[model samples]
Target: MKKFILDLIVKENEHINEDYFVLKLTSNDKLPHMLPGQFVEIKVENSPTTFLRRPISVNFYDKELNELWLLIQIVGNGTRKLSEVQVGDTLNLILPLGNTFSIPGDKNSRLLLVGGGVGFAPMLFLGAYLNDLGYRCDFLLGGRSEANMVQLNEFKRYGEVYTTTEDGSMGEKGYVTQHSLLQKKQFDMIYTCGPTPMMQAVASYAHKRNIACEVSLENMMACGFGTCLCCVTDTVDGNLCVCTEGPVFNITKLKWQI
Candidate 1:
């Protein structure tokens, strides 16, 4: 896909919780075509301590409104600075970066999307894309607690929503992999993004069941292009840059034990 560096106006900076915020950005011109599972590198304008642009997943895009949503978690100085932007602020971004989740061929293929914490960002876009294509989607989301589970109703607009939280303050009292939906329903394909351990477990479960699976790795992608090499992951094809070759990869191509 073609990449573009554009200044987007922040229409809203909604604080979902103490840790998470959603930045709704808009451009005067029509936005470029972006696929599910793609990301954007934002230039932190005023944070002197931060030298690199922070990479964030595309949470959702509303073509009708010309808005792009970024679900951000304030983890460091860079993100902290970003979270402070006002409604009229201009955020520069190199967008539509990285590969996308593969769409299943069969419309009837059962699909499950698993996400944890802020990793739930991309799953929303992916689920919406699949839902628009007449494919059924089930979202299995996990977080530390109910506070961490943002945008539940928005996700439900695209598909069935299931959830898990470590504190038992939400839908289920365990990890997403432990959700009862997995046991009750059979999925033909599974897509996941989360902490490494969580995704590994989900991958393992899918592998054992002989289901097609893909994972979006949360690697450190300092540069949205391949030059950085910071987001490289060992795959069956060798070490590939996640920023360019992926952020998304099929389980068979990954070097994960599963």
Candidate 2:
């Protein structure tokens, strides 16, 4: 595992209600080559409750700026403290961990990218990566309210963006699955990350259509690397480490029940 002392070059609160912050870290050395689904373990220096680092998905990267972006929702003490990080401060990170989303092999591959709440992190990068691989992509975002949605512009560069909020204040009033189904279109593959139920719903829809789907699970984890074995999950294959074996897994390989 490569360790880096990076500068917290930029920090901003993107969404007010949810306390979602977009942090940019710049490394003095070459930034690790990261993939869509990989995450970084960050230590929120000097916190009582948050002793161990928290794992957050890599949201975006700009090679020219030598910067990496993170979409962090301030849930507890760790994130609350992370929100306070200012420009030029230092943060320790172990990055490029966990497996990443697979690249489509064909140019005409039609792809659907779905995300819910802060779970939208990886899917943003996934959409861009898939587009770079010559696949046509469409993004569907779901949130409790418009305030909970973030990084919307990032996905627009990849493909069409469709949104749904629990309340009627946003694009579509309902869930993301509803918006996706409304399109009434079939895709060659599906990729998603979000709350358990949201991902499950998308998986069900894909399965019923006999389309391939992959899910990036958001499990509570520590040692974001594989050594801790804290991110163990039961799958059709066997017990697997979400940190190592996957934060990304094919829906068919998961043991989800009806």
What TM-score do all the candidates reach, one by one?
0.98, 0.93
Flag regions of model 1 displaced more than 4 Å: none
Q: What tens-digit string does per-residue lDDT give for candidate 2 at 94-155?
A: 87788988767778887889999888988887887777767789898999988878878888
lDDT score of residue 43 within candidate 1: 97
Top candidate on lDDT is 1
List, residue by residue over 113-229, the lDDT tens digit for candidate 1: 999999999999999999898999999999999999999999999999999999999999999989999989999999999999999999999999999999998798778899978
lDDT of candidate model 2 versus the reference? 0.83
The ten-residue window of minimal lDDT in model 1 covers: 221-230
Clashing pairs in 1: none
Q: Where does candidate 2 clash, by residue pair?
A: none
TM-score leader: 1
Clashes of each: 0, 0
For residue 41, model 1's alpha carbon misses the true position, in angstroms, by 0.3
